[model samples]
Target: MFYMSTASGIIFLLILFRMDLGKYCDSTSRTAKAFANPLRVKDFWVLMTLPRFWAFGLFMTGVCGIYAVYDQQFPVYFSSFYPNPEDGIRAYGYLNSSQVFVEALCMLFAPWLVSRIGAKNGLILTGTIMFVRILGSGVAVDVWVIASCKMLHALEVPILLVSAFKYIAGNFDSRLSSTIYLVGFQAAQSLTAMFLAPVAGYGYDHIGFSSVYVLMAGVVGVCLLISCLTLRSESSRTPCSTVPDHAPSPPATTAVV
Candidate 1:
């Protein structure tokens, strides 16, 4: 159940950003780049240089990590806490339905927000929203508070996605823009989950969910600090496309000198 929800959640969230991979996204991007590689697209570089992209990517890593970290455990935790596990599951579904509605609004608002304020600034604003939503629940530990946090999920996960694409679209017409942008997000989700989840799970098994919440809150707060520092002073005029992904592959050697 947890796995299905997460996989589907990412799908729904991405759709809520108001774009599609389409049937031939990969084929199309590759074909377009056959003549002039996306690296040669001037706007692609312009978008890449914006500090907001990195900031957006960074805070999103934390945001995704929070959601991913608990996916394997949250429903179980709720079930144990509630007198009726069935009731809890039903409630979780209803909460997700509300979030879907909010996500639809965000699909419209997010682009406007990006256009008016720019992707970097837009992300900073949204990150604050995510922080408040997460941090507000720290003092309270109950199903209702947890459910309230789900409402924030609409913005926390989806807006950053919307912002990332807005920056890509605004600055780049290169075929590789969407591929590169989405790949960066996937890499972010993968890396933190690989390293942090186990340690977090250990904390949960030994201590409790509250400790895990404290740890996640601290992580989000630190990420927000990094976002503020890195996201400003960047624009399509000055992009910073330094995604936290693996380095590009080396070119093939023709022959030994």
Candidate 2:
């Protein structure tokens, strides 16, 4: 919820720097006129053909689940920086070591990961890391160690994002694809997230943080296995890697509300 506000604010500021909100609508009209019979949803409904994309999402979700557990332990991490327990909130602001490096990696090499490894194999590798990392984080209760574990978000967010864009752009029509691919997924994710978040948070507070972490990992593992079965078992080797570069990422404007 906080990051949602932050992202919206940043985009609004970016819009102000370039053009007014009215112009944004006008630009959309122009863009619509520019292409005909573009990417459509009917083209690609079955997602498994695109390699372990579902597995990749599972892996990412596992990594994301960690923060839910970690946040519940904030007082502990906060205590380290501020000797005064009440000043934990202030210490949160001063911690800079992990964030700087993580952001740098996301900005610098995310493209290279997609361009170099290709989304298929790259996601599998990352997903594997996701499974391993979650299990490890739960096993170790060290606060600093958990903080260091956050470096995975850099990988988790962008890797899943770029791969999703790559797959949708290649498989769907450009026009309707915007609504179906971008808006549709965002909507579904937003709805599910609202419900899942509370369970994770409540689980952390009551049942135990480690239990929540393991459940999150279990969710991811199930998805990963399903994706593997669907993609790997298909003997039909009709190459689906057809989209080229210059594929604009659904305007990068669609976010689940």
Candidate 3:
């Protein structure tokens, strides 16, 4: 089933590519370049010097760790609530479907929300929602209650993930946008998983599922505080052109005898 789904996705992307519908409408490409070179390395170091960059990286790490724990443990937590295992599984399925539906709706309105509130404020909103959702999950008694929290989870994805991308692109030079994003989103999340996965497993073993959620809630709450304190409003952001130029000119080649 997974392979079939993957194949379907590949085919759909191919169709889009064939029709040239994959092009970005904006002149600026938001796509990240995967290959590393001297220029990207220099840009990355320049980005690292900013305090806001560290704040954003830490925020991404904490949120991704919380998500990893919730994704792994929620099934066990859900199954424990019902006497019949199948009933618990069915309930979990319903919650997943509802969350996906909510996420779809959130995506439809995400652009408008970003336009109104801006990326920094959007992160604040989503970070708060994520904190609330994780806290609610820790104490939720009914499946429907958890389902409602899952809807909030959908709203967080666009605000945290999409807005973070926009924040990097808009505030920094276009040359550095992709590198900064890759570091903040992908590398930070990967590092969080590597360290936190074992800790979360130990937590589930010793303290049970609810404790894990509570712990995650606290972590996300801290991240929210950091984001609120460090993230600047859109109006106050430095224009990309005014950002310090860090891209290095290519080294001159020497002709060897």
TM-score of each: 0.66, 0.59, 0.81
Per-residue lDDT over 102-206 for candidate 1, one digit per residue giving the tens place of the 0 to 100 score: 988777777666677777676677767666665655444777777776677676556677776665555444455665567556777787788888888898889
Q: What would the per-residue lDDT of candidate 3 be over residues 143-240, giving only the tens digit for each residue?
A: 77776776777787866667887777677666666667788878888778888888888988999778888889988887778778787677887665
- Cα deviation of 133 in candidate 1 (Å)? 3.4
Give the Cα error of residue 14 in candidate 2, in Å. 6.2
Of 1 and 3, which scores higher on lDDT?
Answer: 3
- For this target, which candidate reaches the highest lDDT against the unseen true structure? 3
TM-score of 2: 0.59
| Best candidate according to TM-score | 3
Per-residue CA lDDT of model 2 for 44-157, tens digit only, reads: 444434344443334334433333444455445435445676675554444444555576678677777876765555555555556655655566566566555555555666
Which run of 10 residues does model 1 get worst, by summed lDDT?
238-247
Candidate 3: clashing residue pairs, number? 0
Least accurate stretch of 10 residues (summed lDDT) in model 2?
237-246
